[model samples]
Every structure is written in structure tokens, then in C-alpha cells.
Target chain A: MIRYVIRRLLLAIPTLLAMLTMVFVLVRLVPGDAAVSMLGDQASEQALDALRARLGLDQPIHVQYLTFLGDMLRGDFGTSMSSGRSVLSEVWQVLPYTLELTAAAMVIGVLFGLPLGTFAALYRNRWPDYTTRLLSLTGLSFPGFVSGILMLLAFAVWLRWLPVMSSASSDPLTHMRNLALPALNLGLIMTAYITRVTRSSMLNVLGEDFIRTARAKGVRPGPLVMRHALRNALIPIVTVVGLYFGTLIGNSVLTEIVFTRPGLGKLILGALQSRDYTLLQGLMVIFAAFVILVNLLTDLIYAAVDPRVSYAK
Target chain B: MTPVLDIKGLTTEFRVKNGWHAAVRGIDLSVNANETLAVVGESGSGKSVTALSTLRLLPQTGARISRGEVGFGGRDLTKLSEREMSRIRGNDIAMIFQEPMTSLNPTMTVGDQIAEGLLIHRGMSRTEAAKEARRLLDEVRVPDPARRVNDYPHQFSGGMRQRAMIAIALACRPKLLLADEPTTALDVTVQAQVLSLLDDLKRDRGMAIVFITHNLGVVAQIADRVAVMYAGEIVETATCDTLFADPVHPYTEALLKAMPRVDRKAESLEPIPGSVPSISARPAGCVYAPRCNYVQPSCAAHPSLVPVGGNHEARCPVRADKGEAA
Candidate 1:
């Protein structure tokens, strides 16, 4: 297992390099000039030239790319053009919020979605099954941002039950309270995918001969569903959940924007608007690393859940 | 002796795309203590369904026991609530299925699968159940029971897995073991080994067995009584000696002739002409009429089971009277 993990990490290096190159080139290709965007329209030509030279923006694109790579190898992501703060520090500040949101969403999704899916599969063609299907369909159809806004309106704007926007609070309880609406919004959307995957996987496992054998052994309904059917069903469900975790990390941008919660999504948006190229490139690399990490975790989870799966093979 | 299991007028149905189709028509059968009753038939003849219905383990969504009384240990299984039925399922009555490869839970260790029933029905503590699981594996003749108990189903070969499955079924020492084509997936050698194992276990434990299978060869080896099912009903039943000596029903006769023999240098094997009728499309009257060579015009009405001699019954009027096919 250790050797396998080492091999996986080694394999991730080339992927990370590729992502770095792509993000470096892609962010530069966007229409606005970083120097011009930062300095604003009122700056003189000479002033703009000085600012560009100072920021090393006047260098050739290839030279700049080489410098970026070298500096990254030395663990240096240059200072943000607008804030004059290290891009790493800025990312470090908001990293917890994104992690919190993603983790909360995952917990909520699995907590509700798994039982709903199992219920649907057990009562297939019955009213409960139909209700879950309809609920998931609605969740799938609505975008996360829209739902986030609607939730904000109902809970914060109209009902005065929760805070409208997330605050950078020190207290854990306050942070959770602030996180409720956005987390739930993202969670509900995740629940839809989770429910669908779990339902289909469960349906397949429920028909398996082992399930029948378990039932024939007079295993009660609780242990039969959880120990026999659900565990077997988890392989496919885990795949979906892992893939969606990566997606949630990247796609929580819209939900973050709607809820005005400080996260990588907000950080990236600020970088884009002010043309903080260094900060954007750094965040992109972090995001790519997160996705890779999530994939690794997913593979490990598969081995844990299924005894038939062996990393040595 | 009072039979361990007695079924009277058992009828099971599956709700298909068209409508409700009776898979197991009204049938009566019984299994006594310390005996093996083999219910033999071709596929779709409801042999497996009959076994499933007896345990009330039919699929919950589409299949159901429409009519029946499964009397076991002085209680009607069909009328029992789910909670009550559950108590009898693994404790008093256990089952093993056809596919040994898929019959055990893939995610669980074979030991845990066996120990689960002991834990549930026997009320054994985790450590006690674990010890019993290892003992059961040893009883089933699995090598290195202590080590192999921790191994998952995939690690075991087909024969070993079937042995482990038998260990699980016999974990609670149930009085009745419902083995539904348990050896069908095994090769000839392994099949013989498993059959003999079951036979030995039955004799040792005095457990009644309802062996559901499609092979008459298997029946000849392990069965004390034989029930030949066709369509969705038992067409003939008798003591194994009597049925093999003189099969009264044409379907039973045809089945025996269809068996490949090693004793005689026959020109070729006589394969049964047609397939078993579909559940949804069964003909009125006798279900085996189309396949029977002696299918007379008078065979239009379904024949109720009749006694031909001591402990022998057949569902064909013509054969019951003449004692032979014309």
C-alpha cells in the first residue's frame, strides 16, 4: 500500500506540471492586461511602462513562464499585484472556508441521500420511490447559485433566521451558523447526484444472489440492508461521491459568489477582476493538487470498502 | 414421524409486464426428518420458486405467495408476521443458493458471513461467534480454518466457497435446510463431493433437506423421495426407488429416458422434445400435455394427484389406471 501510494504521487507530478503550464498560458491569454487593469485608465504611458517593468510584465512570455516555473520550484508564488501580499498567504487564509463548505456538503449529501436512495430501491414502484425520484429530479434541474439565492432570501432576507452573508468569525459555532445556507445549497445539489448513484447501485446490489442469501439466513431488515446490500452497493456510489468532491471544490465558485462567503471561489474572482495573474496561477495549481489528492483518497476508500479490491494487484 | 415441513396448496405469483403470472401453481409437498426430498425439474418449472416461497423469501416488489400454508414445527409460515418469520428463517430453517460464487457477500469475510447468523439467532457474543465460525469452517473441511476465516469470498475457489456457504447455512444447526440447486454451478467432481457432504451432514444432524435441482443424476445420488415438477406443479412423486424403477407419469418417464447413462452403449441420448412452458403462457388442463407423448384428447382437463400404490402418486389419469404409459 505504501509503494502504491508513492507510485500514485510520483505519477501526479507530470499531471501537476501539465496543469501548471496550461493555467499559466490560459490566464495570460485572457483579454485584459494585468498592468493596465491594476493601474487604471488615468495612469500615464511612462507610468504604465514603469509599473510593467517593475512587475516583470515587460519580459517576453517565454522568459516569464520560465521564471514562474523556477520560482514555483523554489516555493515562491509572487506577490499579488493589487494587494502586494504573497499569493500563498492569501490562499491559505480562505482555504479553510472552501474545505469546510465541501466537507459539510459531502456529509449532508451522504447522510440524507444514502437512506433516500436505499428507501427508493427497497420500495421500488411505490409512493416513496416516486417521491425520491421527483425530489432528485428537482434538485438536478436547479442550479446551485439559484438555490443558494432562494435559500438566502427565505432564511436570511425574509425569515431573519440566519445571517445573510458569511463573516470571518473566530468562534466555530458562529462560523457554522454563517456556513448553513451556502453549505445546504451546495449540499442539496450534491444530494441529487448522490441519490441517483446510490439508488441505481443499490438496485443492482439488491438483486444480487448474496442479498437473497442474507435474507434467507433470516437477517433482519436493518443489518440485511446496511451490512449486505449497502456495503456491496458502495463501490459505484463511492466513485460518484469522489468525482463530485473534486467537482464541488472547483464548482463551489457560483455558490460562494451568491452567498458572498470568503473562499477560493471569491479569491479567484478577485484575482480575475483585478488581473492578479500570480494569485490566479497559484490558486489554480492548488485547485489541481486538491483534485489529485481527492482522487487518491477515493482509490484508498475503494480498497477499504471492498475486500476484493487489492492495491498489490 | 411428523414431517419437519409441510406445504399444502402453495401458489406463488410474479407480477410481470402483462399481469400476475402464477409461477408455482397449487402444490402440496412435505419433507420428513432425516430425509432428503429432491424437487427436480427443468428451468422455469418453479422448482426454485417453490423453495423460495416455502421460506417466504420471494422478491418483495413483484413476486408473492398468493395462496399457501407452509406448516413447520406446528406454525403456519405463510401466516406469520415478518418478525416471526425472521426468527424461524435462519434459526430453524436455512437455505443455500445455486451460485456459490455470488451467494456469499463480496465485501464480508466468509467467517463474518457465517458468524452473522450465529450472532443474530444464537445470540452469541462477537468473540464466541468468531470461534464458532472457525469451527464451522473446519466442519465444512476448509483448510486452515483459523487463517481462511479472515479471508474474503474472492480468495476462495468455487468449491471452497460452496463449502463456506454450507458452513453458513449450517451455522445455526437448523432442522430444515433448503438447498436450491446448490451444486449446479459446480463441476461433476465437486458436485459429487458437495452432494455427499450434504448427505453426511443430514445423517449426522438429522436435519430434513428440500433439495431443489434440475439433475436426476443428483437426485439419484442424494434423494430419498423424488418430486418431478412440470410447468408450475408437481406432475409425479414417489419414493426414489419406485420412481426410478417405474416412472408412472409420462413426463417422469421422459425425464428418466433423457438422462445420459454410462451403463449402456446407447446409440444416442434421447433429449426431451420441447421446452418447459412459460409461466404467463401455460395451457389449460395438464401443463405437461404438450410435451407428453401419451397426450390424449381426454388430457384437456388438469389431473389432480392420485395414489398409484404405497407412497407413490402421479397427476396423470391414464397412467394412474393402467400403471404404465400406452
Candidate 2:
């Protein structure tokens, strides 16, 4: 298993590098002048040139990519072209907020989705099963941002329970309060996807003759879910969850906008708007690398859940 | 001897896309103390369903016992509440299943899997269960039980795993043991060994056993009484000797013939002409009329079971008096 993990980690490096390279090159190709966006129309040509030289935008694409690649290798992400702040510092500052929301959303999704899906599988075709299906369908249909906006309108605007729109600061313990609604909103779609995958996989596992053995052994519902059903169902749900995490990192921009929180998503948007080449490339690379690393962790987890998956090569 | 387990009119149904699919039609049989009653049938012939129904282990929405009385030790198990049923399962009435490879949990150790019932049903502490589990493994003839018990299910071979299953089932000294094709999946040598083990356990403990199988050889070797099931109902039932020697129903005859015997080498094996009838395509009256050898016009109207002799019965319009076909 240690060998398998090491091999997987090794393989992931090239993949992360390739992904970041693609995002960097693609973002650069989009028609925009970072210096012009930073200086705006009011700044003199000489001032823009000076700013370009300072940000290393004066160099050719190949030279700039080489420099960026070198700095990345050295763990330096350079400063934001718009704000003149260290890209790494900005990323560190915003990551907790994003992590807080995503983590809570994931927890909420699993807490409700796993059991509901298991129930749907256990009592398939019954009222509970039908209700779960209906709820999942509704969840899948509504976008997270739409749900977040509706929640903000309902809770903050009308009920005055939550603050209307503030870039809420991240707190470890109480961050849940600020993130709960946004998390649920982001989680609605994930919950649906996970629940659907789980229900199918749970049904398949439950139908196996082995489940009969567990039942005959008199293992109760909760233990049965934890031990037999969920573990087996995870083989498929793991793939969906892994892919969802990547999409979650990417699509979080809209959710952050809706919730009025300072996170990776808002930073990414700012970088894109101002054509902050250094910061944008750095952010993209960081996001891509982080996502790849998380996926690698998820793969290891999936292997642990299923023994047949070797990860040998 | 008092019956350790009694089942009457055990009919089971599953809700389907169109309507309810009757998985197990009306059937009845019982197992006396220390006796092994083998309910023999092909796959999907309701043998497994009957066993699951007795334990009330079928998935709730998919299946229901439309009519039945599973009387165990004077209590109607079919009528028992969920709590009472849960108490009965794996405690008073234990079951060892087929597919020994998958039957045991992959993630857990063999000892923990066996000890699970002890802790859950018997209320034994983990330490106590672990200690007793090693002893039980030793009893099942597992080698190095002390160390082997700590090993996971995957570490054991096919035979060893089945032995572990038996240990789990017999842990609480259940009065009635339900074994669903315990040896059907095993090889010949393993099958013989498992049968012998089951026989020995039954004899020693005087525990009644409901052995489900399609293999007549295993039944002949182990069962005290035999219930020959066709399309979800018991078509014929008799003492092991009588059922084998003077098999009455055509389906029973076909099953006996279907089995490959070592005593005789025949020119060509007679494969049953058609496939087992589907649950969806069940005929109006007779379930096995399309497949029977001595099938008659009256056979179209399904024959209810009637006594042919003392403690021997069959379900056929044309009784065995009109003997074998041709």
C-alpha cells in the first residue's frame, strides 16, 4: 500500500504540471493586456510600461512561462499585478473561507445523502424512496448560486436572521454559521449527484448475497450501512465525489459571489478581470495543483474502500 | 419429537413494475429437533426467498409474506414484531449462507466476523467474544485457531471460510439453523466435508436444520426429510430413504434424474427439455405442467398436495399409482 501510494503520488506530478500548464497557456491566450488593465485609460504610456517591466510582462511569452515555471519550482508564486500583494499570501488568506464552505457542504451532503440514499436502497419503491428521489431531482435541477441567492433573499433580506451581504471573515468554529446556508446551497447539487450514485451503488451492493449474510448475522441498520453497504457503495461514489471536488473548486466562483465571501473564487475573478497575468497564472496553477493533489488523496481513499483497486501501476 | 421449526402456507410476493410478483407460492414443511430438512430447488425457485421470509430478512419494499405461519418453538415467527424477530435472528435461529468467499465481511477479521453474533446477540463483551471465537474456530477444525482467528476472511480458503460461517451460526447455540445451499458452491471434496461437518454438528447439538440446495447428492448424504420444490411450492416430500427410493412426483423424478450419479455411466444425459418457468410467466393452474413427464389434461388444474403414505406426500393429479412414464 505504501508503494502504491508513492507510485500514485509520482504519477500525479506530471498530471498536475500538465493541467497547470494548460490553464496558464489558455488564460494567457485570451485577448487582454495585463498592463493596460492595471494602468487603466487614465495612466500615461510610460507609467504602463514601467508597471509592465515591474510585473515581468515586458518579457516574451516563452520567457515569462520559463520564469513562472522556475518560481513555481522554488515555491514562489510572485505578487498580484492588481493589488501588488504576494499571490501565495492571497491564496493562503482566501483558502480557509473556500475550504470552510466546501468542507461544510461535503459534511452536510454526506450526513444527509449517505443515509437517505441507503434508505432509498433499503426500502426501494416505498414512500421514503420516492421522497428521496423527488428531493434529489429538485436538488439536481437548481444551481447552487440560485439556491444561495434565494436563501440570502429569504433569510437575510426578509427574515433579517443573517447579515444581508458581507464578505464574512473565516472563523474555524463559528465559520459554519456564515457558511451553513452557502454550504447547503453549494451542496444541493453535490447531494443530488452523490445520493443518486449512492442509491444505485447501495442497491447493487444490498442485492448481493453477502448482504444477506450480514442481515442473518443480525447486524443492525446503522452498522450495516457503515460496514457493508457504504463501504461497497463507495467504489462508485468515490469517483463521483472526486470529480465533484474539482468541479466544486472551479464552480465555486458563483457561489462565493452569491454569499459575498472573500475566497479563491473571488480572487480568481479579480485576476481574470484585471488581466493580472502573474497572479492569474499563479492562482490557476495553485488551484490546478491543489485539485490534482486532492484527487490523488481521494484515489488513495477509494483504494482503501475497495481492495480490488490496486493502484499498482 | 416436537418440531423445532414449522412453516405453513408460506406464500411470499414482491411488488413489481406491473403488479406483485409471487416469488414463493403456498408451501409448508417443518424440521424436527435434531433433523435436517432439505428444501431442494434450482436457483430462483423460491428456496432462498422462503429462507429469507422465515427470518423476515427480505428488503421491506421489495418483498412481503402475503400468507404464512413460521412457528418456531410454539411462537409464530411470521407474526412476531420486528424487535422480537431481531432477537430471534442470529440468536435463537442462526443462518449460514452460500458464497463463503463473499459471505464474510472483507474488511473485518475472521474472528470479529464470527464474534459479531456473540457480541450482538449473546451480549458477550468484545474480549470474551474474541476468546470464545478462537475456541469456536478450533471446534470447526480451523488450523491455528488462535492466530488464524485474527486473519481476515480473504486469508482463508473456500472450505475454511464455510467453517467460519458455521461457527458464527452455531455461536449462540441456535435451536434452528438455516443453511442456504451451504455446500452447493464448494467443490466435491469440500462439499462432502461440509456435509459431514453439518451432520456431526446437528447430531451433537440436536439443532434442527433447514438446508436449502439443488444438489440431491448432498441431500441424500445429510437430510433426514426432503422437500422437493418446483416453481416455489413443495411438489413432493418424504423421508430421505423413501424420497430417493420411491420418488412420486414427476418433478421429483426429474430432479433425481438431473443429478449426475457416480454409480451409473449413461449414454447421454437427459437435460430437462425446457428452462425453469419464469416467475413472470407462471401458468394459470399448474406451475410445472409444461415440464412434467406424466402430464395430463387434469394436470392443467394444479394438484394440491395429498398424503400418498404415512409421512410421505406428493402434489400430482395422477398419483404414483399410475407409476413412471412408459
Query: What TM-score, over all chains together, does every model reach?
Result: 0.96, 0.89
Tens-digit lDDT track of model 1 for A161-184: 999988679898888899998889
Where's the lowest-lDDT run of ten residues in candidate 2 chain A?
A165-174
Residue A132 in candidate 2, Cα distance off native in Å: 3.5
lDDT of 1: 0.90
Model 1 Cα lDDT, one tens digit per residue, B1-326? 89999999999999989599999999999999999999999999999999998888987778989998899999889999999989988889999999999899999999999999999998999999999999999998999999999999999999999999999999999999999999999989999999999999999999999999989999999999999999899989999999999899998998888888898556566778989989889999888888888888889998899988888999999789766431
Each candidate's number of clashing pairs is: 0, 0
- Against the true structure, candidate 2 reaches a TM-score of 0.89
- Name the top TM-score candidate: 1
For model 1 chain A, the run of ten residues with the poorest summed lDDT: A244-253
Fnat across every predicted model, in order: 0.85, 0.55
Note the B-chain TM-score for every model: 0.97, 0.96
